[model samples]
Target: MTERVCVGAIAGAFGVRGEVRLKSFTSQPNDIAAYAPLYTEDGSRSFTVRLTRPVTGGLGARLSGVETREQAEALKGVTLWADRDKLPALPDDEFYHADLIGLSVHDTGGALLGKVRAIYDHGAGDILEIHGPGRRRVLLLPFTRAFVPTVDLAAGRIVADPPDEQE
Candidate 1:
């Protein structure tokens, strides 16, 4: 796997001074700046983020080479990446979404279910999306211990004990 990790996204321009609306993915929002020189998905472009101030959704940031609203807007929707090593080490129970990607998911019975497709955070909390065969579907599993008791990064898999079927 590559060392690139997504840390945030550009949400269009914030002002006429090249400041762009930044939506950081860090738990400590300001840490986005600490991971300087973020890169685009393909590594073709990079940026140094300087948070100018707080905004409703995230932060207003200045990109190193961007100097206009138009330029900033052009970067909207671009996810910024940083070297994985640059990120602070997480605690034992904590895991970075980037690390979960591509991890195989299986039931307690040792049956293969799917692989992690994406992690979603819609304000409330994080949800794991698993993609796989007959069980191949995006299951919005709550990222809590009770829901997902085990995540073995070393084994490259997750043990999901889904809730009892209501139907």
Candidate 2:
């Protein structure tokens, strides 16, 4: 697991002011600001988030040193990461997307399926994208208790009950 987890992203400038259109990945969207002093992916720079208001697609927020529209615009597409310690702990059933990625997947019969490449949330629920070995095509499995039976993070593996092979 990483020391820092991605919490939000800067969509772009909200208006002519220094406020940025921020997209929060946190469970509670507004909690993104509570985990202040977020850092960039490479940990090169950091910003203290102050959410101004809710905008069309996301939230309007201002960064510590961002005082101009140009500065906010320049931060577009930048993912904001917060220290893992600052985030709340999850229940045993819940797992972080970052922790699931790259984990080897297997069936109840111990047949290797693939590795988790990514996780997607299309509003309804989470989906795991598995790829490699016998999986010639990307396998998108719903990350539900029915499909995913066990996730042993310490073992770096996932036990899945995938649907029958597609022709």
TM per candidate comes to: 0.93, 0.97
Candidate 1 is scored at a TM of 0.93
**Model 2 error, position 55 (Å):** 0.6
Count of clashes in candidate 1: 1
Q: Which parts of model 2 are misplaced by more than 4 Å?
A: none
Model 1 RMSD vs true structure: 1.6
Candidate 2, residues 1-167: lDDT per residue as tens digits? 98999999999998887999999999989999999899999999999988999999899998999999999999999999999999999999998788999999999999999999999999999999999785678989999999999999999999999999784
Candidate No. with top TM-score: 2
lDDT of each candidate versus the true structure: 0.87, 0.93
lDDT for residue 86 in candidate 1, whole number 0-100: 93
Provide the lowest-lDDT 10-residue window in model 2.
131-140
Model 1, runs deviating above 4 Å? none
TM-score of 2: 0.97
What 10-residue stretch in candidate 1 is worst by lDDT? 131-140
